[model samples]
Target: MQPHQIVSREEWIAARKTHLDREKEFTKARDRLSEERRALPWVKVGKAYLFDGPAGKATLADLFWGRSQLVVQHFMFAPDWTEGCKSCSFWADGFERMVPHLAARDTTLVAVSRAPLAKLDAFRARMGWTFDWYSSAANDFNHDYAVSFTPDEIKSGGKIYNFGTSGFGVEEAPGISVFYRDEEGNVFHTYSCFARGLDMMNAAYHYLDLTPLGRHEQGLPYPMDWLRLRDQYQPAPGKGACGGS
Candidate 1:
């Protein structure tokens, strides 16, 4: 491939204008799809699911935390897993800043995992996050959303249904489920999405585009191998050994 050339000011302006025009078209199409999505039929959640919160055990209704709307992210953390899934952890990290803004809009956001409350708390402490997280240990909430795998699923070696994708066994895919409460205090499931819908949490894509390497791989999952908690990361030898060396 030919090396990219640095363009003059006028050329830069012209290129930017072309990109902006394309972006505008993309935005219009995105908005139209969103409207279509909003028009879909609602599903009523008949089963009463339980979740473990910081304050203690709570029902699905209680997850609203007095807010009229609730948004739950099914985080990947089974009870026995030692650590949260790396990709899901990236998304969860954004919740700290988003929670306050969501609260102002009268929407409460929380992350639910199948892990025990004690285990979730310990992992959160290790990651140094302040966002609200809860345990769904006693319920089939994850399985219901097609985010958790069952023992039978593991044993069958057949296609396990999940997130509109079928192939080998199904594994937890990051997902978002929304719910709204009516005047009668009945909570109705409004919407849910997985995979591409979770793109808002992807900062690596933005960063990769600005780097020389670009995204390096075509079909791989998001580039999670490079990130680490701020305190846990260390620069490699001769990598950060700059000017003096």
Candidate 2:
């Protein structure tokens, strides 16, 4: 944090109005980009990918829950990992509350991870999340989507993530893949975004961007080094009986 620049009311209002104009232009540009994104051609999903959910083994289409559209959050939980990624968990925390709104739009949003169904269930229970989560352990869905890297690829540092050869810090990364189901039971992959492309999903980050600090992750070891699952935050120093505040 830095010292606040105190200014006269008239000066502050003038500066604010200038910034507001720029913000409005940025908003319009964002709207145009979104329109372009929706215009992208969708590809037909040919693979018969299967997932393990609470009910039992299910196909990709079955996970849509009778909806015509599906949004799958590529949660970064490996089969052997004890917990999901904290950053991904931060994103998942926002998901449960959006279910009804998505349902109203005839879209189903679910999470798919490489972790086993039991692990996912236990973690979801711990997080108190109600959104549907499934395990892609039975199929190459994660690999096909470029969210999970193979052990060999990780070791060699030649894996492609976010559609590039540049490696990621972890074998598993985060992403969102959208699908559209037709009346005839055919499904098409509408779109998929990775890396910073997922910023739209985290409402908290956008709110913070309006503040002085603006996410404030600069100089940290990782951009999300300060992030933790909802329950893992420790009390601030001196907030206890000690005089540390």
Candidate 3:
């Protein structure tokens, strides 16, 4: 950890109060942005997306499970991969706990991936995650959402992700999409955010933001290169010893 300035109680309080004012302003700005996000126009979903699950095929509307709103985590697990992406798993770990809370607010949270339903189920069970997860292997949901890129698209250097703002060549990417179901059972695509826009949805990252090291990763190959699947992490050390890769 970098050394921080030592300060007297009076000096510390004065500094903290100054920072607090900025935090309040930031909080208000975030509130206004959220309101604007909610007010954005929606697009009617024309495709009848069918997702494969343990129970069988389920449409996008069926995924809502009677809720008026649905939140889909576009997880990055391709059909051939034996395991899900470590970073996507990190986000999923936090999302599983939020299922009940979101349901209480009439919102359904689920994860969708391009991997086969069996593969998804196996990986999910290995991670001990129970939040609803489905496979889009039988449909074009992933491509339609711009989270999965075709081999040709990658070969030609496609820039379809993030609304064509980026040229990520990976076979899959991570995103969050929101949909609203009206009384007539029409599902509308409300909003979708990709890349760092997902940072706010992760509780652990926010907690880390308050720490001195702040996710570390200074010289790492990538921001999440140090991450391991939950079961793959080394056991925590005793007392103050650092551990768990």
Candidate 4:
């Protein structure tokens, strides 16, 4: 817990400017990568997937709410589980505020989970999130999107996760999928990302990246090991006072 090398104002400015050049380079490179991602070919979504939301039954196109584009957060809340995944909750905490902004741009953002609508609604209320969350309990949306694995799939080694052949030993995984709807009501899957590819979508993670410690996940069994549901985080040690000897 020591401070970095101290420097005079002139020296600090010079060093910061040098780093700023590298940051700009990275920004440009990221812009190009985003362009490439948008250029990826899309696939037509033929399945008539349905979801149970607060407003009753909804289809994939209906989730868009008259918007041409949709962003689905594949939340990992299994029907058998009492609550949503902590990691998924961490990701969702950043979603509520973006709903209106996304709608303004002709895009809608919503969450899709396999848990029943009542469970999803109760948990959403507990989390105090206003984002539209829907249940895929009656549809193959979660399975088709590669978020929820079937019992047979798990028993035989769930290898379809993250688009890899490695056997994932879990019934649920987190992901995001994007879709587009044309004038004729045709829906298409434009993009989907799993695992670490979703890093950019979490604002807290990006904010952590700007600090000196940068997530501070070292020495842990895994990244996000320190995370908890927003309401579950314990008060910071002493609320900032040092411990007594």
Candidate 5:
């Protein structure tokens, strides 16, 4: 490939406009897809699902928490696992501020994991997050949603299948499930999406795309590595490190 060169201000502006026009089409397409998804038929979830809450046991209907709608994010934290997945944790971090707005819209947003309540709480404390999280340790909810694997499936080494006839297998796939409650107290599943569908909530990627590096990693989920609770984030040591100090 030819060596990259910095362009002049006029050239940069023109290029930016061209990029923005393309991006506009993408945005419009996404909006249209979202509308179409919303129009899909609702699937009634009559089966009772269990969840461990802060106070005690809760059912799938209880997830609404008195709201008409509920959004559950399948966070990657198996019951036997020690900690949450790094990428899932990053997505969970954004829910702190979004909870209020979702509540205002008569929707409750919560993170659901396969980990036990105690372990989930511990990790949440370490992360300093206040978003509501619950355990689905005793149920097949995660497996049903293609977020977790069954013991037998794991033993067979064919657990990472997607939702299809050929057996949908995936490794701790991230997902968002939406539910709505009717006047008669029946809950219905409205929408569910996984993987890239959840990308908008990733603030890191959105910010990185504006930088020169621009998420350079080809196969990595996000550009930044997993951050620990106690880790102090310092900019990469470089020429600009002392410029603003």
Candidate 6:
């Protein structure tokens, strides 16, 4: 932490106004970038990707759930892992509450992981999340989306993600992929964002950004190095790997 500066009312107002101008510019730039993102060309999906969900086996189009637009969060949970990535869990914490709102907008949001459906269901129950989560265990969805890497790729140092083959250490990474379905039932890959690109989805991080501490992640090996599963926070009772489910 740094020393605080005390200033008169007028001085603080002037400083705030100057900062507000920069904030306005940033807002405009962000809107323009969003427009550009929407303008990006779409690619038709040709694979028969399959997923296991609460309703049994489903195809990529089935995951759309009658919605024209679909948003898939590529959760980093391997088939054998009993728990999901803590960072992804942070993002998932606030997602269930947005379901109806996203539904009203004709968009369906769901999480896809390499873990089996049983594992996903149990974990979701433990976390008390209601959002639809599916398993990509029987498909190439994760690998095709560049979120999952093979052991061979790791051994060969040949995995590529976020448009590059660097700065990654784990077999799985987090990302958001968007899709659109046409009236004729054809599906198109719309847009995808990885790394810190998905930061805006975390409300807690946004609130933290508004404070003087500002995420307080500096000097750490990783920005989220301090993160743990929601139940794992000390003084908070941890419900074991299976939780209460």
> Highest lDDT, which number?
3
In candidate 3, list every pair of residues with a backbone clash: none
Global lDDT of each candidate:
0.80, 0.91, 0.92, 0.90, 0.80, 0.91
Residue-by-residue lDDT tens digits, candidate 4, 1-245: 33898999999999999999999999999999999999999999999988899899999989999989999999999999999999999899987799999999999999999999999999999999999999999988888888888778889864678886456678899999999999999999999999889888999999988998988998888877888888876666656323443
Ranking by lDDT: 3, 2, 6, 4, 5, 1
lDDT of 3 by residue, 1-245 (tens): 78899989999999999999999999999999999999999999999878897678899999999999999999999998989999899999998888999999999999999999888989999999999899999899999988999888888876778998888878999999999999999999999999999999999999999988998988999889889998886555553324434
Candidate 6: misplaced stretches above 4 Å? Answer: 165-167, 236-245
Give the candidate number with the greatest TM-score: 3
lDDT of 5 by residue, 38-96 (tens): 89999899788888988699999988889999999989887678888877877777667
lDDT of 1 by residue, 1-245 (tens): 23987999999999989989999998999899989977888887889898888988899989888999999988988777888877788777766678889999999999999989998899889888887899988998888877787778767776554444653344555788899887677988888877667775567566766677776664456455666554456667666624343
On the 0 to 100 scale, the lDDT of residue 208 in model 4 is: 89
For candidate 2, the per-residue lDDT at 167 reads 81
User: Where does model 1 exceed 4 Å of error?
Assistant: 155-162, 168-171, 210-213, 217-223, 227-231, 236-245
Clashes of each: 0, 0, 0, 0, 7, 0
lDDT of 6 by residue, 36-95 (tens): 999999999998998899798999999999999999999999999988998999999978
Model 3 CA RMSD to the hidden true structure, in angstroms: 2.3
Return the TM-score for candidate 5, rounded to 2 decimals. Answer: 0.84
Positional deviation of residue 168's Cα in model 3 after best superposition, in angstroms: 0.8
Shift in Å, residue 214, candidate 5: 1.4
**Candidate 3, after superposition: displacement of residue 95 in Å?**
0.9
- In candidate 4, stretches whose alpha carbon ends up further than 4 angstroms from where it belongs are 1-3, 237-245
lDDT of 2 by residue, 1-245 (tens): 87988999999999999999999999999999999989999999999998899789899989889999999999999998999989899999888899989999999999999999999999999999999999999899998999988778778777487779468767799999999999999999999999889999999998999899999999999788999888888777658434356
User: Between 2 and 6, whose lDDT is larger?
Assistant: 2
Superposition error at 55 for model 5 (Å): 2.3
